[model samples]
Target: MKGGATVPIGLTPEQGQLQEAVGRFAARHAAVDQTRDSFEALAEGALPKWWNDLVSHGFHAVHLPDGVGGQGGSLLDAACVIESASAALLPGPLLPTVIAGAIVLSVDDMAAAKLLSELAAGATATVVLPESGDLSATATDGGWRVTGASGDVLGVRSAAVILAAARRDDGETLWFVLDPEVASASVEQRDGTDLTIDVGMLRLADHVVPEALVLNGIDDDAAWDITVALSACASAGTLQWAVDAVTEHLRTREQFGKPIGTFQALQHEAAMLLVNSELAAAAAWDAVRAVAEAPEQRQLAAAGAAIMAVAPAPELLLDALTMFGAIGFTWEHDVHLYWRRATSLAASMGPITGWSRRLGELSKTHVRDMTVKIGEAEADFRAGIAAVLDEALGLVNDKPSPLGDYDHLASGPQRTLIADAGLMAPHWPPPWGLGATPLQQLIIDDEFAKRPELVRPSLNIAEWVLPSIISSGSEVVQQQLIPPTQRGELLWCQLFSEPGAGSDLAALSTRAVKVDGGWRINGHKIWTSSAQYADYGALLARTDPDAPKHKGIGYFIIDMRADGVEIQPIKTADRDPHFNEVFLADVFVPDEMLLGGPTDGWSLAIATMAQERVAIGAYVNIDRAIALRRLAAQRGPDQDAVVRALGELDAYTNAIKALGVRETIRLLDGQSAGPASSIAKVATSIMLRRTFKATLELAGPLAMVERSEPAIVAPYLRLPAELIGGGTRQIQLNIIAQMIMGLPRK
Candidate 1:
C-alpha cells in the first residue's frame, strides 16, 4: 500500500526545502522494505549499506561547526534530517551518533574536531549517559581509570567509540571518550525491542582513558538534555510516519458499506492523532531551536519535548495500530516496527514523570518566550506605533477593563484615538485599518502588549461579524457599521444559533419573507451573547423555504431595538446574565441591510465562522496556569505533585502558544489558517478544561463553596461554555478529520 504524504513540519522555507530533500533521499535509499531487510544485519552489529550514502551528504555533521568539518548548520537543520530519516525507519546509529556529537562539541571543541570529522567520514558513535549506566572514574597518573558496566546502550555494538559518563568517588560526574577497541573494554550485544538499530552493554575493566579524552565541559544533566532533544526529533519523525500510514489506510480501507474514515468515531480519533503529531513536531522543533538560539532554555525545552513528544510516543503509536485494526497486528505490516521503535525510544528517554517535575522546577524562574520576531524594517513602524499608544495611554483614566467584556468599552476619546489611528484592527483595509500585513499586525500587538494600561476598545461580536460586512456587505452597510463598530460605539451580536440550530447553522428555520422595500424576519435566537446591549446583529434567515437548506438563507443586519425585537437574558450556571434569547416578530430589515445575494449566506456564514475559530484559537489564556502557580507558591515547595501538574500545564500551554505562532507564520506566508484553526480550537478547549480542573484540585476545600473565591469556582463553572460555544469540540474534531486528514465526511 502506498503511504499518504508526510505532513509538513518545517518552521521556515529553507528548513522546508531541506526536509523535502531529506525525505526524498530516505525514500530512495532507506525505504521501509530496505530497513526491514536490514534487521538481521543491524542485530549483528553491521552498519547499513546506505550509512556511507547518508554521511556523504554530511547528515551527521549538519549541526556541527564548519571549522570542525561540519555543514555549519543549526541544530534545527540536523533535526529536519533526523525526522525525515526516522520517518523512513532508516537502519543505523544516526540518532546516537548525533547525540554523542552534540555533547562532545558543546564541551571540548578540539576533541570534537577529530570525532566530528570522523563522524562526517562515516564513523558511528554512541552516548551512554549516567541514567543509562553505572560507572566510576578514579584519577591516576596522566589518565583516569574507569571500571563499570553500561546498561543497554543503543548503537553501542556498531560504534567506533563510546561517549560514557562515570561518577567520581565524590559523586561528581565525568564524561570521557573511550575507544571501543581499548584493551580492557568489551561490548555484549543485547536483544532490544527496536529492530532497526543495535543495542548492547559496554563493560569497562580498569580501562585507562588519556587526560585529553576526558571531557571537562559536560555533566550528566547537560548530556541528558542533548539526548532528549535529539530523541524527541526522531520520535516526532516516527509519529509522522505513523500518521501518514494510518491516514492512507483510513482513506482507502472500507467497512460497513463505506470507508471507515467516514465514521465519526474514527474521524475524531484520526483528527486527534493528527493534532498530537503536530504538537509533537512543534515540541521537537522548539527543542532544537532552543539549542541553537537560547542555550539557557535548552533544559526547559527538552523537558517539554520529553513530556509532550518523546515519552508519549509508545502509547501514541500503539493507538495508531488500534486504528489500523487486525492488519496492523500482523508481523508482516510495517506499523509494528514503528511501535517497537517508539517503545524503545520512550524507554531510552527515561520516565516522563521526572521530566514533568523537572519542567515545573525550571518554569518557576524561566519561561519559554512566545514573542514573534519582526524584521528590522518594522523598527520605524514600531516606534511610530509606540508614540500613538503612549498618547492613548495618557488619555485613559486608570487601567481600562478587559477587551471582551460587554460593559467595559473604552472611553470615547480613547476609542476615537485608537480607531482613527487604525490600531483597533490593523489587519483591516485602509481608512478603517492600515491594511497591515501579518508582520505589522504582530508588531502592533507587541506595542499594545507593552502598555497594558491602554486597553483597545472591545468590538466583542463585531470583531467576528464586521469582517463579513467588510468582505460581502454593500457600501452602505460597510459605511454604516464598520467605523462605529471599530470605535466601540456600535456593539453587535450573532443571531445565527437558535434552539433548533446551534452547530448546524444552515438548518436554521427562521423565516425572512420579502415584503415591500424590505424583508420581515420572524425567528428565535438562543444563547446569543450580549444581545441585550447589541446595537445590531448579524442575522441569518431562510428567504426561500423550498430551496436547499444551505442555499436559501440570507445574511442580514437586524436592528436590535427595532419594533417587535425582544431580548430575554438567560442566566448561566455561573449566575451571570451574559447570554440571551432574542425573539424577532416581524422585524423588518431593509434591502440594503442584506449582506450578499439572497442565496449567498451559507458561504458568508462559513467565512464568518472560520474567522471566529481563528480568533478563538489565537487567544491563549494562561490565567489558569498563572493562578495555579500562585496557589502552588502559597502552598510551599514540598508539593512535588503540584509542581508536576504545573509543569504539565505549562507544557500544554506552550504547545498551544506554539500552534498560534505557527498559524501566524502561515498567514505571514500568505497561507490560509486551514484545519489548524479547528485543531487549535479543540486543543485550547481541552487545555483549558485540564488547567481549570487542576487549579480547582489545587485549591482543595476552598473550591467547594460557590462564594469561596470567584476566580477558583467561576472559571470551573464556565468551562462548559467553552466546550459548547464556537462549534462544539466534537464538531471541531469532525471538521479537522475531514479537512486536514482528508477523511470522508459523515
Candidate 2:
C-alpha cells in the first residue's frame, strides 16, 4: 500500500504463500463433520486414513527447515495452518507428528530429516517421551533405550515411529528415536473429556538408539521449546475455536425476541472470552518466539497462557454451550467437538492450570535470571512511584471540597493525574510503562489509588476513546487520534446502550452503509455519556443487517462536530445531565477512522468493555466501602445492630476478597474465572447495600438529616447508583448461578 516498510510480525511472504497452499491441500482432505463422527466410532487403536493426507499436505514438516526436507515454513505459518485445521475440528495425527518432528530437529538430530520427510510424505509419527512428568528426560543404558513410557502421546496409536526422551548414565536426558516396526510397542486407551487428542500410553521396551539418534541431552533448551510450542499452539487453537463458536451463537441465536448477544450477561461472558483469547494468543506467540526472547520473558509468557487456558477458556466454552441449550450437547452439533478438543488438549498437557504450577516452579528460576539483566525503565518507574507515594501521602489530609467525604468523584482527578504520570500504563504496551514485570503492575496499581487524595481514572472522554483506538485502529488513526485524546486534549463520547437494547447491544438497529469513499452512518444511540460535549464519538452501528447479528456490526470513530449529529443530554439518578441521547442523522466516517476491519468491531468492543467492567469492579467500589467504614467509626458506641452487621460484613468481605484473589489467580494461571468475578461483582453490590443500610440505621434517626449541600449525602446515596452503573446486579447473579454453578436459569 504506501511505502511498504511495515514489519509483519514473524510472517514471511514465502511462508504465507506456502501456508495458503498447505491450507488448501489440507482442507481438501480435512475431516468433515461426518469424518470426525466416523473416526470416533472406530474402536481399537485405528486412526482415520485421512490423517495420511495431512502428512502429504506437508503439515508435519511445516515448521522444519529446508535442510530437513521441509518447506522450511515459518512459525506463523504453522500457527495459521494449524488454527484453520483446528477450527474445522480436523481429526488426525498432526499435533503429535509436528511436535515429534520439532523435537527431533530441536536436539540437532540428523535422523529427523528422514523421519520428518516420511511424516511429510504421509507416515504419521509421535513423540513418546520428554523425560517423564516434569518433561526432563531421564536414565539410560545400551546407548539410550525407550524405557519409562510417555503417557500423553496423542498419535502414539497411529505412529509408525516414535521419538522418546531418555537420560544417559551422565544424568542427561536425550531424545531417542523408536521405529515402532522395530520396537515392542503398545498404546494404552484412555477416555477423556476433551476429545481432540485420542490420548494413549506408548509402551516401549528394549528399543535402542545410539549417540547419533540421541538428539540432545535433557538440558537441551530446544527440546523443551518444541514440546511447549506444540502444546501451546494446540491450546491456542482450542481457545480460538471455543471463542469463535460462542461468539457466533451469542450473536445469531435469539432470546426474548432479540439477539441474545445484546444481553449484558452474555456480553460480559463474551468479554471474558475475548480477554482470555488475546492473553492466550499473546502467551502462545510469546512461547513460540521465546527461543529468541530473554529467558524469563519466555517463561512468563507461557505462564500467562497456562493461567488463562485452565479457567476462563474452559468456563467460557461450557458457558457458551449451556447458553446454546440442548442442541450443543448432541453429537451432530459441531460445538461439542470444540469442547472435547479444548479439555482434551488441556488434559494432554496437564491442562493450563498445571502449566501455571509449572510456571510457579519456573518462576523460581526466573528470579535469578533477572539478576543477569539490566532493566532501567521499570526500575526507575517503580522507585519513582513508591518514593513519591510514601512521601506525599502524609500531606494529603483531605479535600477542601465536599469531595473529601464523597471520594467517588474526589478520587477521579487524582486518578487522572496518576494516569498522566504513566502509572496506569503498566498493562499498556511499551510506549506506556515497563513492558516487563507484569507482577509489579498490581503493586503500583494499588499505590496509584491508595496514595493520599486517592484519585481514580476519569469516566468521560479519555477512558472511552483513547484505549479503544489504540487497540484496533491503524497506526495512522492512533497517531492522529490517541496523543491528543490521551493528553486530555479531545473529549469523546460513547454512542451505545440504546433504550431498546440497553444490555442487548448487538440487537441495535442503527445502520451504517458504505457511501462514496467512506461510510454514511445514520443511527440513534441512547444512554450516551458526554455526547453533548463530545468532539468525537465511539459509535457502534449495524453495517449489514442482512448479515448475521455480530457479523454485521461495525465500530467507527465519528466526528461529533459533523453537521448531522445531534445530542440530547439525559439526567440520571444523580440529578445531573451526564449521559447523552445521540442521534446520528447521517454521519460520515472514512476508512481511516474505522477500527480494525468491519466485523472485528464486535471483538474490539467486547475487549474494551471487559476491561472496563472488571476495572469498575476493582476500583470504583472501594471508596463507597471506605466511606461506609469511616462513617460507621464516627457513629459512637451505641449502635449494636450496626456493629453486629459490620462484624458479619467483615467476615463475608474477607471470604469474598479471598475468593476474588484466587479466581483472579486462576484466570491468570490459565484456568477459568468460573463465576468467581460474577459472584464478586454481585456480592460487592449486595454488601454495599448492607453497609448503607447499617449507616442509615446508625444515623440514629439523623439518617433522614438532610444537608443544604447535596454533596454531603453523596457518600450515602451513591451505593444504589453504582449497583446499576456498569451492568445490573441481577445479570451478574444470573451469570454466576447459570455459568459458574451450573444452576438452572430462572
Quality of model 1 by C-alpha lDDT? 0.82
Instruction: Give the Cα error of residue 129 in candidate 2, in Å.
Output: 3.8
Q: Quote the positional error of residue 603 for candidate 2 in Å.
A: 21
Put down candidate 1 lDDT per residue, 1-746, tens digits, no spaces. 12443345566778878888787878889888888878888987898887787888888878888876788988878888888878878788999998888887777556656777777667899998985678898989998888999989999999998888888877888778888987899999899899999999999999898878877888577678778888988999889988898888888899988888898888888778888888887787777666744655778888888988888888889889999999889999998999998889988987789999898888777888767777675788889899998998767433343334333375477777888898877888977789999999888888888887676566667778888888887887788888878777777888889998778998999999999998999989999888887889999999999999989999999999999899999999999876899999999999998888888899989988887887777656445676667665665554777788889988877877776777688788887554567777888888888888888777777787876543678677877776777888899888777777778875
Q: 588 in model 1: Cα distance from truth in Å?
A: 0.6
List, residue by residue over 1-746, the lDDT tens digit for candidate 2.
11111111123345446545654765676545545655553323466666655656666667777775676766656765665566556676677777666555544445656766666666677775545533233345545554555666676666777777655556666666676666365567666454544556766665556666655533344555555655656665666666566666765778788877667676666545544444444445445555546655555544444444333445656766776779998887777777766666655555443444444444333421111112343666667777756654443323222212433323333444444555545566655434535445555754564564654334343464567776777888877765555444466777767778876778888888888888998878886766776678888888888988878888889988997898887777556665678887878788888787877778767766655556556532353334334444454675334434444344234334434444444444454334445545665676677666665665555555544222234556545546765668766644543454333233
lDDT of model 1 at residue 326? 91
| Top candidate (TM-score) | 1
Each model's lDDT comes to 0.82, 0.58
Model 2 root-mean-square deviation:
14.5
lDDT at residue 540 of model 1 (Cα atoms): 91
TM-score of 2: 0.52
**C-alpha TM-score for every candidate:** 0.95, 0.52
